[model samples]
Target chain A: MKNKTILLASRPNGVPTQENFAFEVQDVPALQEGHVLLKSLYVSVDPYMRGRMSDAASYVAPYTVGEPITGGIVAEVIDSRNPQFPKGTVVMDRLPWQQYIVHDGSGLSKISPDIAPLSYHLGILGMPGLTAYFGLLHIGDPKPGETVVVSGAAGAVGTVVGQIAKLKGCRVVGVAGSDDKIAYLKEALGFDEAINYKTVGDLKEAMAQACPDGVDVYFDNVGGEISDAVYLKLNKFARIAICGQIAYYNATSAPTGMRVEPILLKKSALMKGFIVSDFAQNFNTAAKDLVTWLKEGKLQYQETISEGFENIPQAFLGLFSGENTGKQLVKVADREG
Target chain B: MKNKTILLASRPNGVPTQENFAFEVQDVPALQEGHVLLKSLYVSVDPYMRGRMSDAASYVAPYTVGEPITGGIVAEVIDSRNPQFPKGTVVMDRLPWQQYIVHDGSGLSKISPDIAPLSYHLGILGMPGLTAYFGLLHIGDPKPGETVVVSGAAGAVGTVVGQIAKLKGCRVVGVAGSDDKIAYLKEALGFDEAINYKTVGDLKEAMAQACPDGVDVYFDNVGGEISDAVYLKLNKFARIAICGQIAYYNATSAPTGMRVEPILLKKSALMKGFIVSDFAQNFNTAAKDLVTWLKEGKLQYQETISEGFENIPQAFLGLFSGENTGKQLVKVADREG
Candidate 1:
């Protein structure tokens, strides 16, 4: 059988386009003694992946050209030479953007269909969930009666952050790009107040109205002007968790905004930047808590899935445009027994 | 007897001048039942005092126009009606810029002459000493073998910070203004490395060479371009203690510079701004530890005393110009028995 894979054709200067990716077809190699042959079911497209596309040194290494774009993928095992793997088993791994993959079980976790869904393992039960969990609890540390303001509030991570802040008995305010997202956050996710940042005339004023007591904990997913405005409203001893900077991710050159240290000094605030993987040691506890919250209906999750393996690039590109409201993913194939 | 006082003649637009203060001579008043007549000896002038001169709301209330500028003052009680304050008692209080004044002992701490010099109460054994103690130990938390970089290294708090970091067994680097200050930091204070930020062409490159292992803890006393340079060299999970921002204290408008969140996010670093008073609850232990360190010769202290009451404004103005190498204090009069 033949396998079709998408490779990074070229690194884009600014925003990525269809031309940045190329597809290749090759015969699927037979599994080695410790290898398992798998067919892709779902692939996660995350904002952090934007950092990998660039050559600049970051927390993670840059993705090389002519290599398959790899990320969190859920696949069903069809053939195996290892005793640990059997046919019909589902697994999650850092797999390439391809119709089929061969895995050695390294960095692979078996997915149980009884948990939630296969797609969830790519999002709420996975990276996005852990991002919200640790970033809020560990960094933000929202106290009861304290106010929390989260940017990118309608996105997968932001939505979970707002819900978790509410569960901690904090007054939660959300900022998003669209009116639909604002409504979804307030009505569906039970956000105390949500604002459409694009429509707001003055974000600082809008934030002031939402967080009357001033923000004590800010879980920031979208940085730039939104964060600058948030800095102005920070209360004494406020904690800010920097999860993502999606606003400047696609910019061709470095963006300059407000100098942060002066304001941080004035307000005696704390700001920290981090990635989800930094808390890998605590993932097991976080996943269990997430599962319990999911069962208790205290945590809600959403996804924007595009069908077909060919649409992987499109789904990833859509993140910059704010086209997807939730966890953006691509469905490669149907689940099989 | 006549008492000489300096009142705020006018609020400064940016950098304070002699015109901002006016001298007044008034008759010393008799002590009331609960009050003691204070004869000023030594008064402290700090960078944080500049914030009080402005009308903007901050950690401390704005100093009122035409009122005597009040701060940490060490004085001797000449006449006392309050039984608790006997004559010849050396005390510390938030007193005014005056030669002789009356105080109620509400915020007063009786200073024992047996402990240290009378001027020491306004510096190393006083507020500035407590500031370096809590800010570095609590916020920076420099672990042994980690690299600790302190800005404004020749200044009062900065001097102690570098010494304490060394006491903690960390590699200490200092950024000062003058060559003399740099010499003092390396030769006298035993700083591992000292950089004259004013003379350096590219501070980032200088910092790179000085801290080859990268900066793990940054005790930031002077903010602005100097701080921007420090941010570039932060290692992953670095902790920054924002004790002061003297560089931007005199700015007429907000200064904009490089955005910090992206770098912070990439490095997973933590930056916190704080005033020494935030750790008021732990002051007793800190002060005791500081005294112990001083007695054990592990901690060193320095003072820059300006003679006469008239030089108070000059001493304060000197802070912006980097004129004083250590804790800046104005001596009004000698202790009266």
Candidate 2:
């Protein structure tokens, strides 16, 4: 069988571009014992993928030049020598941006379509889901009547975070880049208030007006001026969960903003930075809770999926431009039964 | 009796000077029922006092103009209407910088002279000591064989923090502005490593050399470039206790530095800013442990006494210049029996 893969042709100095990627066509290797053959069905293009494209030190290892870019992928088992992953099994694996992958079944996790759609595993039932789950519940520790303000509210993690805070009986406020996202967060996601940061004359004033009571927990996904304004209105003993700094992800030089030490000291605030994998040990518990919420309709999710194997790079790049309204995914091919 | 008091004459824009304080002579009021007359002995001069001198938002309320400067004072009971505090009884009180004060015994805490020196209550046995204890044990949570770095290592709180981390069986590194402070931290406070930030050509390189194993727990009393260097070496899951930001205490304009969100996210680190009062519920427990350590000869403390009530402003101003090695106190008068 033939396979097409996207390779990292060059490292990006800042924002990644199509010039940084190259295409390669190769033959899919025959599955050995304990191995499985996967036909890519859906590929996840996440904001965090931007971190792996650079050579800088990060939580995960950087993708080297000439290697295929790998991330979360939902695939169908075409062939299996492993008993655990039989033919026609739908699974989630950290696979390369490829049409087909021959895996040793090491990191392959079997997915049940009965739980939700197969594509949901790459989103609300997957990494993005677990990120919001642990970051909000464990780190945020939102209480009833407390106010939760989340950045990137229209995105996958932010949408879930705002809703989770709402379910916890909190006053939920969201900050996004566009007016449509702001409307979606308040109208569709049931957020108590939403602010379009780009349209607001003064973000601090808007945040103050939205949160009559100061922010108790700030779920920061898009760090920059938006976060700077949020810090100003944080209540005493506020908890700030630093999930992503996507605003500075594309900066060529060092990023500078309002110094937070004085604000943090005055408020006695707790700012913690973490990736979803940091809570790997508790993934099962979090995943179970997420699945239950989705089943009960307590949690809602949306995805902006681009079509074809070749658009994976574009889908990943679109994240910086705020082009996608939820989880951004690339549909590679149909699942083979 | 005539009493001399130091008042906040004017708010400081940046670093406070002698002109910011005003001296006044007032008639001492007769002690009412349940009140006692206190003769000030020793007054503490702390970096946090700098914050109170400025009319800015802080953990504590700003000192209004013409109000007497109040802080930790070691005083002797001169006369008592309240039988609970008899003459010659030594106590620690949040008293103004005055030669005499009549107290109603509301917030006054009696100190046992046998535990350590009477002046020690304003240092290792008082707020700074409690700050080092809880901020380290509760927030930093240093474990055995881990690397703990403390900035402002020769200051009152920083000295105690390094010693406490040592008792916890961790390798402790200290950073200070002067060579003498660095030497005192290693020789007197038992810190395993000491870095003179002023003398070091490259702070990041020096920190890398000193903390070859990487920093596990960081107790930051001084924030700025020193903290920036330490942030670079934080290990995964590192905890930073932000006790004080003395480095930016005197800045006239807004302080700016490298954004920490990216580094913190990559390391999965936790940074918490706290005042000693945040752990008030646990102060007694921490104080008991601190007193025990002092009695056991496991803890050592040194004080730089600036003699006379008139020298209180000078003592406070000296904090910015790094003049004092350990606890800086102004001796107001001789202990009266």
Candidate 3:
């Protein structure tokens, strides 16, 4: 069978461009024993994908030149040689920007449509969901009545973090780029307060007014100036879980790194960095809990889906501009999410 | 009777000078009921005193000019109207630095000489001892067979940290100044390894050699290049307890604007600053344990005694140059170890 694929052509210096990615027409080889054939149902385009495009060492392996870019995707198994995965079954696998994939069923996970949207697994009930789950609960450790300040508050991870903090009895405050996202963050996602960082003149004062008691747990997904300002107002013995630095990830060399020793010294605070891969052992527990949260309507998700394999690059680029509220995904074939 | 006292004359710039201190003799007035006339026997010279000399804010209150400096001291009650503390009952008190203090018996803990030297209550059995106890156990939280690196390892707190870590089954590595101090750290303090930072060209390389598995717990008394280098070698989830930054205490301003943000991001480490005052509630338990350890010969202590109350300023200034080993103390009158 014929397949369409998007290959990483080069590593970009700053924001990735079309020049760094190339489209390709390839053959889908016959599946061997205990294998299945997958037709791409939903292609997940995420901000974390930007890290995989670079050669720098990170939590996940970087994509090499000429290799297909891979991310979470839901697919329909058209043919199967494995007893566990049957024909016409819907499954989730690390599918690249490809039309079809022949897999040995090793990395594929079966999914139930009755659970939620197939695309939601690419978001609220999938990796992004689990990322927010463990990152907030394990690292944030939000106590009842404590204040939680989350950067990237309108994004996939941030949205979940705010809601989870609320569930845990914390006053949830979010920082985002646009007013619309902020509105959605506060109104839709049940956040206590949302600050449009782009519109705010004095972020420190604004954050202070919102969080009068000071932040006890800071869920930092977007690092840089926003994180810097939050670092100053941290309460004594505050816990900061460093999930990602999407804001600073694109810097060519380094940012004008401010001094953080004062934070540790004055407040006796703790700052920790982690990737979800470290918690792979408990991925099931995290994913199951996330799914339960979504099915119960306690968790909400939003995705900006770009149509066709041709617009995958644009969908990936939307992440840098904060154009997507939750997860950004690319739709390849007929599938209702 | 006439009593002499040393007062904080002015806030210090960089390294403190004699000009920052004022020595004056005041006439001793008659004590009232429930009051005692006590003579200061030995005064402790500690790095934390530098913070008190600065008018700037800190965890502890800064000392004001024209006010007598107060810290750990061993005193002998000359005359007691309180009836609680009799004459010649050696005790520890947080009184103004003077040859004689005429005040009510408050915040004074009577010391038993049968336990150890009276001077040790000002060193191993007092605030420094508790600081090491809590900072290492609760903050640093070292585990069995883990590599522990302690800066200023021959100093009062550092010596106790090494001995305690040794008892905890950790491989204690000492970083100190001079060959003699290094020898003392290894042979006397029971540190598994000692690195003379003054002679080592590259502290990071030396640390790597000493702790091949990487540093687990770092008890930092100095916060300069050596501490920064040790930070680079921190293993995953390492804990650093910032006891005192004696290295930068003498600077006119703060640090020469060197960014210390990497300590948080790169290592995913925890750096916590602390003052012994925060652990006042645990004073009794810590004192009993330390006193027992000393009597059982599990712990050892050394005092660099600079004779006379007149040399208190000199003794404090010497801390910046690493001139003293173990605890630095000044004998104001007839005092015995």
Provide TM-scores for the models.
Answer: 0.98, 0.98, 0.90
Candidate 3 regions off by >4 Å? A49-57, A93-97, A252-256, A279-296, B190-192, B247-268, B277-285, B335-337
Give one digit per residue, the lDDT tens place, for model 3 in A76-180.
Answer: 888889898888889997877788888888878888888887888788887777888887898779999999999998888888889889889999999999999
- B80-137, model 2: which lDDT tens digit per residue? 9998999999989788988999998887888887888889999999999999998899
**Residues A269-290, model 2: lDDT tens digits:** 9999998888889999888888
Per-model TM-score of chain B: 0.98, 0.98, 0.96
lDDT of 3 by residue, B1-337 (tens): 9889999999887888889999999999898999988888889989888988987666668988999988888998888898898887888877888999987888888888788777888888887888899899988999999999999999999999999999999999999999999999888788989999999888788888999898999998887778767876777678888887777777665353333443344456667777777777887888788888888999989999999999999998899899999999998988422
Off by over 4 Å in 1: none
Pairs that collide in candidate 2 are none
Residue B105 error for model 1, in Å? 1.7
Q: What is the Å distance of residue B119 in model 3 from its true position? A: 2.0
Q: In terms of TM-score, which candidate is stronger, 2 or 3?
A: 2
Clashing pairs in 1: none
TM-score of 2: 0.98
Ranking by DockQ: 2, 1, 3
